[model samples]
Target: MSAKTIMIQGTASHVGKSVLVAALCRIFKQDGYRVAPFKSQNMALNSFVTRDGGEMGRAQVVQAEAAGLEPSVDMNPILLKPTGHASSQVVVLGKPVGNLSAMGYHTDYAPKALAIIEGALNRLLAANDMVVIEGAGSPAEVNLQEHEIVNMRIARMAQAPVLLVADIDKGGALASVVGTLELIAPDDRARVRGIIINKFRGDISLFQPAVKFLEEKTGKPVIGVVPYFQGFRVQEEDTIPEDRSRAELVEEQGWVDIAVVNLPHISNFTDFDPLEDEPDVRLRYVSKGSNLDEPDLIILPGSKNTIGDLAFLNRSGLAAQIVEFYRRGTPVIGICGGFQMLGRELNDPLHTESEIPRLDGLGLLDTSTTFAPEKITTQVEAEVAGSGLFLCETSDNRINGYEIHMGRTELAPDVRPAFTILVRSGEKVFFPDGAVSPDGLVFGTYIHGIFDSDSFRRRLINTLRRRKGLEPLQASDTLLVHEQRERDFDKLAAVVRSSLAMEKIYGLLGMEGPICHG
Candidate 1:
């Protein structure tokens, strides 16, 4: 039997489509169905590396985890990481195709891209009992609809029932939903089986009349009214929430204050989520021109455009501030692009990433980086080669993380290696991964998620605390990152099951009776 498919398209960006897909994936998995999530294309700076050395959008990775499955590049066939305001680095099936502008991508690439999208979708359908598809932006984007492979086109290809989701918290939920349905082509509009009013704040009971009115006017069932859920952490696709301000960090008042230099085109910001979860650590993303506030530890995060963002740091004077902080004996760490920025120079002779031929780095680390044509997207296992300020007290020196970068970093002969890479993509290997200063005050690594290990995070936080003349705090018994996400998946599934009309959804999918086991 062919697998059943359902597509979730949003009225606009960040209308909670990704979260809803994740919730449904968990719900289906709990109901004894082998489920998977798929997106034809995703445009986001945030990304994840699959176990097979493939890179995809972080949202699909979260949804895959929700479905109790490993992430795969097929889940998100095309990922566009924006390098500038108008240009993006396009990845097809986990490999960099080339940088392209919006017109170039749509006019020259969309047709071929659609074939790959369908191929991936078909493969997932063949393997899973159900596949949940999440569309980008809106099908109502009439200007882009002609070449839209992610929304109605995929809906038509799979003949999947569509759920149009609108964020009620942003207001105009009814009009947005109705307007979207009305704007799309009639055949595509007919594919929408239901409407989901998402992010509804205040009393949900008060929204019953509005739901009724919507269903009455559109002849589509208001399948769900999802309340604005808080404290449910999931990996966002592109941008960080604006409400995550420095004020909140100050109020939280953890023992150690860590500032992340948020670059203009920051990628994989979720790399620091584990640190944010630590009770003794206060993590804040300090943008260009923002005050660093004398942070005990400063982090230069991964960026989509390393050279461009490095210039940004220089132009914004954040680079100078970082140097001053390092000189003052405060710990500074760099990851991926940030690691490249910490080196003596960044050379892009082939213009692999940007037009910049060569750019001087902050010179914090005795290393240089050269942009390479082949992008590295692989999982890695490494052990601390030498004890640094952060790794000094870590009980388990072994770390598990992934690498996704476009440059190869070479350290000066006299520089100390930070971590020795043991395995790449599940195979054993031997190589140094990062550089550490003689004083252990500055560190740079190509590895993302280096702080995910609980022992590592705890040790780093406590070490900073000790430097501030504070006693060490007890280690947290909290769940690991993966385990916590599994629990979050269940929590989200439970809420969605209660909020949504499951019977109606099953009816739309042409399934009957309860599939849940317990």
Candidate 2:
């Protein structure tokens, strides 16, 4: 019941802290330990709903999967979802408290949040053999140290050894590490047992000198210099890396082409990670002002701000382009906020999302949505109830995914329901979700991660293939995305274990003996 713990603290945001924690979680699990991933607080737009209908960051969800455990809100007690420039919707233990300004959160919420974090940490420690804690931003932010609930605060509370990580690819890796160590308090600095240089792209031999410099500068062992990795696909914790440039979105060779409209406040884009991994689909993320290409399918992805982003689509002319694509027989599917946008109108009387009281939707589906204070965050099992392009082969229309939204949609009598909700948050339920046009061309659903359902995803792509005069692909060699993710966990663990000083890691965890994996 007494769990050994290690914390991965990064020099700054997006320095690969989340990925490193995931790798260690997998390594510990492979070493025959009951490992769990924990973060006292997480600030991210990409989120996942647990079975109990509690919402938490997807990074912890990935780490939980790597540790071979189901995600729980206790793994992440506090979640900060940014709603605007100065405000965030604070969620404690997987439920929303309110949208509070940064100052208000520090003054009113931090004291109470620390207790919640302590309770969650104790629960995880009691249940697991080991727990991997991840820090947010920098512990060196002196201005927020008094109110900080993540980073050194949690590390000290958990009495965990800290592995300070720096992104060598960002230049001045040594400086960042030294500067961080200098800024944090002496006791917090003492907690840092080692240093890790992440995202090193160049020759490893050339970087050896700098690693030595960091170790000498901070008096901490340079645990590893992880080279920039590829091939294995995992979810990026927060926003897409700005430097992660892609080639032209149109590959011009795939049977079923899909272009996802990337909105300004895009959330849960990980929903399409499965589609991007599929060899048969040529997927692209089309930005708001980017030139549109005629693809077989156009997807309106989930947005954090339904009213605000819909206004952006209309003002930016992407809405017109989407209508044109739909008119020319290109199929369209909207998800979450996107689904709300496809409706006839959206009303926000309570200002739950934004100041706009009402805004006109794309009118693709004969439905209307109204924003409510009650946000629905639940996992669902649904079956296709209406005939549509994606539902052409209805022999197997059962699909499961999670929903996180605040609006409720009501379909018109003429439009058919898209899906029938069979189960919600692990309970029996009967309700209609989304709507389909009479012609069965355009449809919208609030379900995120719907494409993760292998059979349903394959059917969608195979139907597109038939429409394009290509033969329907048989589902003989279908592999579930979750299975592939398990393989990825092992692949990542192997890479990191080879790069890092795993023996020292075990020593730091107060354990010994090299474990073998089959």
Candidate 3:
């Protein structure tokens, strides 16, 4: 049988494009079809490690989950991680090779990117019954459309049928549907087989007239309309713009509010996810123009471009605000890039020409960070260095995490000591490489994912609660909530699998008949 591919192009980003593609992958997989999820390229810091030690966007990982398969680097060939507007760290099949500007990638590497896309597609075709491809941001971003490697070109190369997805929740999604069709080249427009309206809230039937009008105008079928599912916890793809209405922030049960400095190009912002699951702790992402509002703790998060973000923080006046927060006895914590920013100065002479012209840091920690060419990437297990912030009264707990950064920090004089660098990389290498300040108020390390441990989370929340005069949370309740959410996500999959037209979906995906349910 010939390979039949389905491409899901979004009218805009964060529409239910990823989820819809995932649902389709699951539906076909249950019908006894081997399916794979493909994205020609992705720009996200929310990434996942494949079994082969390669990394790709986490959205692909979730889609792989829906298909009951493990994630592989081949599923996403090109990954563009924006370190700054002018430059991005480019990864080919999950390895950081070099950095390039957006224009440089488009002009110099478009042909090569095409080859990579084709190579990934060829493998998918040979191995799977169908390949479901997810597209990037808006299809109509005119400035970014030329020599495109992701959405349209990949579709054309694979000779796949396209299903345009619009986020009806974003409002004017109908307009997005029409606008996308109008913007594409005539030949490209012909490839669209249908459209899917996704993430509609309340009474989907209310939009029947709007749906009919769009179908009549574009002459493409509306395959399905998916409603919003609340409890589904698909891994996020990027730093979803920090909004006030985030559930994690509002529903936080932690008595202490932890403020994270939102940098311009925040890396691995999802480091806060495990912490979000704790009912007691509220994680606040504080960006420029936002007030500190007296947070119990101030955390400096990782940054893709540290020096650039430092300058941005200074420009936004948040840097001064942070200094003030430190003076006011607020506990300050820095992680990775945030840790670098807490130093007296950051030296990047290799990339920048300036020397000795120090960018003022928070000065909470007596340290200086020097940026180097090399990046560190690997999983690590560590014991609490000295007494960590959360478990000051208690002893070390096993912390499993990873490190991804480029810098060396040397502690300055007169700062209180926090963690003593203990075992690293399976060796008893202690106190030589990394350390926290003495007071424990200013703490940091190059480690990312430092809070993946459930014990660490509970201790942090319990510490915050005790400080705020609140009772400790029951462990059973938290476990029950997460279990219920997973059950809900499973039901969500069943809903999508049963609602869409099965025969047509199987035919579109080049799959045999569905198995008998009875």
Candidate 4:
């Protein structure tokens, strides 16, 4: 049988294209069809390394889980990490090739970009019974329509029927969908097979008229109106700052409140997931305009654009608020770019190279960060600070995580050292990497996945509980929640496998029955 394909295109970014593709992949895989998720390109810092040493966007990683498969770099060929206003770090087929300005990327690399995308498609073609391709941004961006590698062009190249998706929650989704279809060239529009109205909050019955109108006018079927469910298990495609989680609203049960500053370009916030798994603690991701009045602890998460986001934080008054929190004896921690922001000064004078200029840091820690042309990327282990108020309460808990950044930092003489010089490779440990104040209440680290360790996470969470006069939750209870969450996802995939029209979908994917468990 020939490979059949389906594509999910969006009217704009964050419009539920990734989630729709994930659901479809799950449903098709359940019907005994081997399925895989594909995206020609993605612009995100949330990335994961596959077991086979391949890299793919985190969205595809989640979709791969939904499809009962491991992630692969071939699933997402080109990854563009926007580092500044106009500059982006480009990854070609999972490896860092170079950095490019927006115009430079499109004008100089379009031909080669297409070649790499086609190469990734070829890999997906070899592995799966069917493939689901996800489009990037909007298909209707006419200026970018010509050299598009992640949208209709890739769909046409793969010969997949596109499923257009728009978020009803965004308002005027009908017009957005219709307008997107109308704006695209005739050939591109012809590839659309159906449409799905995503994130419908109210009764689906009320939208029947609009759905029918769209189907009638566009001559395309309305496949589904997926309602928003509170417990849905899917990896987020972008940094959604909205207070959508039911888990966040639950009372802490006298547990500690750990508020993490939600930066504009927060990367790998997953570092805090283990802590969220703890039942006795409340992990509140506070976005802009939210009060930081009484957070027992405030965590500054990693950011893709440090200087630019720090500028955002300073302008939004979060910087001053952080200082106030520190003065109040509240534990404030920064990770990666957040660590950089806590320094005395940040020097990025080459405004021609990026958006951030040499700006003053929060100045909580006596340290400074300087940007380098090359990024530091590695996995390592470190021992926590031996002499800090925060460390005094902790036992021997080792930290393990990867570091990815393009800056060098050193502590000022007034501050006590955080982590001792245990190990440093990748050449020249210019300075003692992570920084800690003499008291340990204020600290920063370059590590990305430190909280993945249950013991370390519990120590931090329990500290907050101690400060808040709350009861402590046992570690076993917290891990169980995550186990249940994963099991629920597997169940979700099973449901999709059973309910969808499998045979037709399978036929479209160019695969016959008897899907491999692998």
Candidate 5:
């Protein structure tokens, strides 16, 4: 029998549709059902690579994890990573087809993309007991609704009951819900079995009147009003978070100060998410306009456009400041495009990444990068070399990360390799992966999600603790990213369960399941 499905569509982007879908997936899994998450098309910079070398959006990755499944491209059939304001690198079923403009993609490619999306959806439905589908942006975009496969079209195709969500925190949520229902086709509106007001604050009772009005106006029940919650560590597939104040986090004597330079087109920023969970770590994103405070460590994250973002670093003066920090004993590291930006120079012969043919790098490491036409999107296993200044504390040599870039970096003969590649894309490979400076302070690697490994993250934090003369915490039951996420998923499932009308939600599915406590 084909799996049952429910679609979650937002009134607008970032309306908490992704989080809700993940929560529901966890709820279904906890109540004894084989559940999976699906998103027809995702446009985000945050992405993850599967073991078999397929790349998909991180939102579905989180949802898949909630459902107790490994991330795969089948979960998210289409991923569009924005390369510029108007253009994006379109990846169908986890591999890049080509970069296309907004008009080009919608006008010329939507038909083919829709076919691929449906095929993937049918496969997911056949494999799982239930598939929780998440939509992108809004279905009410009248001009684009005809061609947009991410919203109502997929809902109708799957015959999935729709849960329309609106962010009340953004205001006029009632109007948004009513307007969306009115704007969509009558048949599409009929599929919306319920409504949800997400990210609500204050007493939920105070919003009861509005909820009642919403229900009456749309002829649907306001199934839930999810409160604004914190401390739940789910990776977001939206914009970069603003820089935050340290504010005496972790309840410790001191902090492991870290500054991540937020690039214009930063990608896979979830690399630093694990750092924020550290008990004494003060994780901060240093954007272009923000002041770069002196931190124990500085990181340059992956970028979509190496040359353009590197030039941004130059114009913003972050490059010079980062070099100054490295000279002053601060450890610096870069990943992917950021890895290329740390070299002596970057050469784009075929203009694969950017319009500029060549650009000077930060020159922190003794390396040079050359952009190639082919992109590398693969899972990697490596042994961290004990060569970097702060790497002496590494208790674990085996670390795993994914590479998504189009540049090849070569290290100077005198510089040490940061990590030795063991296996790449299921193939055994023996080669250097990254470069470490002579003093072992500045380093750059192609590894994304490197810090997610507990062994590596804890030791790195301990290294910074030693520098500050703070006592190191012994590793006992430290939470790995995977473990922590499982717990968080349970917590999220609990929160959502209590907030929503569970019986009614299951009623919408036309199926009965056990109701378990959070």
Candidate 6:
């Protein structure tokens, strides 16, 4: 039998579609159903490498974790990582096809992409007991409706009942719901089963008349009014609001201050989530060179366009600040594209990332990088190569992270290797990964999740504290990072269950009542 399916589409982008899908996935899995999440197309720089070496959006990875399943490329079939303002690098089935302009993708590639989407959807439906589908942006883009492959098109293909979600925190929640329903075609509008008011801040009791007005006007029930939740943690998918003012650089005071140089096309900023969880760390993203304050550490994050972002660093004067920080004995670390930028030179012979043939780097590491056509996407396990560094207390320390980059870095003869990767893509391998300067003040690596390990994080922080003549801190008593993630899933599921009308939702899925409160 085909699996039951439900689609959640937002009235606008960042309307809580990803979080709601994750909540439902957790709820269903707790109730003893094999659930999976699917998104036909995703456009973001945040991505993940599956166990089988396939690449997909990180949001689906979070949802898959909530569902107690391994992430699969079929969960996110098409990924569009923007390389330029007008063009994007398209990945179909976990590999890069090529870069295409927006017009070219819509005009020439939409049909083929639609076919790929349907094939993946069918396979997912056959395997799972239930599938929670999330839509991108909005379905009310009437101008792009004919070429739409993500929203209403997938809903019709799966025959899934739709729950339109609107953020009440943003004003015009009622108008957005009414406007979206009015814009879609009559038949497409009929598929919407109910409306969910998400991210509500004020007292819900005061909103009863508003909910009643919406129901009377649109003839659809307000199925839920989810309050604004602050502590719930989930991997966000390129939805960070741009209007919020950038944080000001502040004194460390009692905590270790960390500054991450915000690149032009910053990818995988979620790499710093673990640091945010640490109580003694104050992490901030600084975009301007003048904003670089004296901090315990400075990190150069991954970027979608390395050469372009490197040029941005040069033009914005942030490169000079980074060099000054290194000269002053402050620890500076780089990952992936950031690792490439820390080297002596970056060469793009075939214009893989940019038209620039060669560009000078920050000159912090004795290494050079060259862009290649093939991108590496794999999981890895590595051991610290030596002691007396930020990431390792002993040479036996093991760290796990994933590699996602297109450049091949070559180290100088005199530089010391940082970590020796023992496994790649679930296979045994022995190879050096990164470089460390002689002074131990600068390093660069391709690993993304190196800080998630408690032992490594504690050692690094305590080492910095000792440098400042401060006492060492106690190791975290909280759960391990992965276990904390599981608990967070349960917390989100509880909030969703209490707020949403599950009886109506189950009825729409053709399931009988006495819904399991999992």
Question: In candidate 4, how many clashes are counted?
Answer: 6
Model 6: residues >4 Å from true position, as ranges?
Answer: 240-253, 386-388, 393-396, 513-518
lDDT, candidate 1, 1-518, per-residue tens: 37999999999999999999999998898889999999999999999898888889999998998998989898999999888878889989998888999999998898889889888988899999889999999899989999888999999898899999999888888999889988998898889999998988887788789988999999999998888887667777776755253333332334678899989888889988887766566678898667998898999999988998998899999999999888888889999999899999999999887788999999999999999888899999998886668656344789899999989999899998889999999898998998988788888899998888777777787788789887776665332676777777888888889999988988988999467664
Provide backbone clash counts, one per model: 0, 0, 11, 6, 0, 0
Q: List the residue pairs that clash in candidate 4.
A: 2-510, 4-508, 4-509, 4-510, 27-496, 30-497
Which candidate model has the greater TM-score, 2 or 3?
Answer: 2
What's the C-alpha lDDT at position 377 in model 3? 58
Please provide, for model 3 over 52-99, each residue's C-alpha lDDT reduced to its tens digit, 9 standing for 90 to 100.
Answer: 556677778778877778787888888877776567788787778888
Give the least accurate 10-residue stretch of model 6, judged by summed lDDT. Answer: 241-250
Best by TM-score: 5
**TM-scores for candidates 1 onward, in order:** 0.96, 0.96, 0.86, 0.85, 0.97, 0.95
In the range 392-493, model 2's lDDT, one tens digit per residue, is: 546777899899999999988888888889999788999898888887889899888889989888888887888888766666644479888988989999
Scored by lDDT, the top model is: 2
RMSD list, candidates in order: 2.0, 2.1, 3.8, 3.9, 1.6, 2.5
Task: Give one digit per residue, the lDDT tens place, for model 5 in 38-75.
Answer: 99999999998999889899999999999999898989
Which pairs, if any, clash in model 5? Answer: none
- How many Å off is the CA of 373 in candidate 6? 0.5
lDDT of 4 by residue, 36-136 (tens): 89998898978765443444577888788777787778888888877776777887776677778899988888667888788778778877778888998
Sort by TM-score, best first: what order?
5, 1, 2, 6, 3, 4
The per-residue C-alpha lDDT of model 1 at residue 467 equals 92
TM-score result, candidate 4: 0.85
**lDDT of every model, 2 decimals:** 0.87, 0.88, 0.73, 0.75, 0.87, 0.87
The segments of candidate 1 whose C-alpha lies over 4 angstroms from its true place after superposition are: 243-254, 393-395, 477-479
| lDDT for 386 (candidate 5) | 44
